[model samples]
Target: MTIAGSDSGGGAGIQADLRTFAFHCVHGASVLTCITAQNTQGVTRVDAMSPEAVTAQFEAVMIDMRVGAIKTGMLLNQEIIKTVAKKLVAFGCGNVVVDPVMVSRAGAQLLDDDAVKTIREQLIPLAAITTPNRYEAQILADMEIHTLEDMQTAAQKIYKLGARSVLVKGGGFTNELKGIDVWFDGDRLEVLQTEVIDTPHTHGTGCTLSAAIAANLALGKPHFQAVQDAKNYVTEALKYSLAIGQGQGPVGHFYPLLNRG
Candidate 1:
């Protein structure tokens, strides 16, 4: 299941996540915390859902479905973050993958300090794996990430925040660091690299990667294996990224189906 916001543009948020789950052959369920009026051009408006509505969606899904794994994205505010974290614990949910969406790649803060603190203190610790992009990693680990070693250090530091593992994503990196992700479990620190697909249509990459990780976990792959497989999946998907919008588009989540002959 994906607990996230809605992207009306169909490039990210719940839309991208469900598409990713479908590609992995996992049944996708969702709890929408907010909605965005956006397209490739850019976001024009965002409306947050009430915490009660978020809880209702969670209750409805958790009762009927046997959610094998779960991923979270674009949780809009502190109230929603707290509500989701509380419910996850109450339901004894496991195999949680957290995509910390607090900061943009360009160093813009998406969530306020309170929400970020709630994510760090309340939500992320419940994650089986927490995936943070470069900027978000800096916030979580309290350090600037400028090199591979810094990424490794940040991954290790973030691991101490209680996630079973931390994946410091390199999507925002330039030069050779591009597409290089650092994974740090309590014991192992490893760098994961994949071929960089040179394309501007990478809008949903972060959401898609975390969703793929959750999907692989649902398929019973081990944590490290799941993260590795997800990286490969995202790399391949990027090869078929769509260039439809005036601005950045999205990875081709249905690439396999598109190539069926």
Candidate 2:
């Protein structure tokens, strides 16, 4: 299941997440925390759901569904963050893949300082694996990330927060360094790389990658293998990105289906 916001444009958030789960052959479920009036042009307004409503969704899923794993994206505020975290623990939901969604791929700030703090303190520690893009990693680690060494440091620091593993995504890097992700699990540091697909329609890449990781975990793949598979999936999706909107669009979640013919 994915606990995330809704993107009315259907490029990211719940739309991308469910599609990603489907591609992995997993039954997808969602608990929406916010609804955004957005398109490829950019996000305009966001309306967050009440914490009670959010918890109600969690209860419904936990009771009825045999959820193998879960991922979180675009948790709107501290109330929602704490609420989701509390319920996850109450129900003994493990294999939590946290996508620390504080910024957009275009470098827009999607979260406030208070919400960032809550994610760091409350949500991240509960993660089986936490995937933070370059900008989000910099914010969480309290350091500027410039080189690969910095990414390694950030991964280690984020792991110190109690996540069993950390994936510091480098897709934000342009030119030669693009599409490299740093993985660290307190003992070993590994870099996962993919050939960058040169395309403007790369929105929702972060959301899709994390959701893919969650789906792989649900299928019982181990930590490193899951992250690696998700990275490869995102890279391939980028190759088939759609040019649907006036601005940047989304990676193709059903690219494999396109290849199936």
Best by the TM-score measure: 1
Candidate 1 residues lying further than 4 Å off, grouped into runs, are none
- Show pairs that collide, candidate 1: none
| Least accurate 10 contiguous residues by lDDT in model 2 | 103-112
lDDT, residue 217, model 1: 97
Tens digits of per-residue lDDT for model 2, 12-53: 999999999999999999999999999998889999999999
How would you encode candidate 1's per-residue C-alpha lDDT over 141-227 as one tens digit per residue?
Answer: 999999999999999999999999999999898868998999999999999999989999998899999999999999999999999
Q: Note the Cα lDDT for every prediction shown.
A: 0.94, 0.92
C-alpha lDDT of candidate 2 relative to the true structure:
0.92
Measured against the true structure, the TM-scores of the candidates, in listed sequence, are 0.98, 0.98
For model 2, the superposed segments whose C-alpha errors exceed 4 Å read none
Clashes of each: 0, 0
Q: Best candidate, lDDT-wise? A: 1
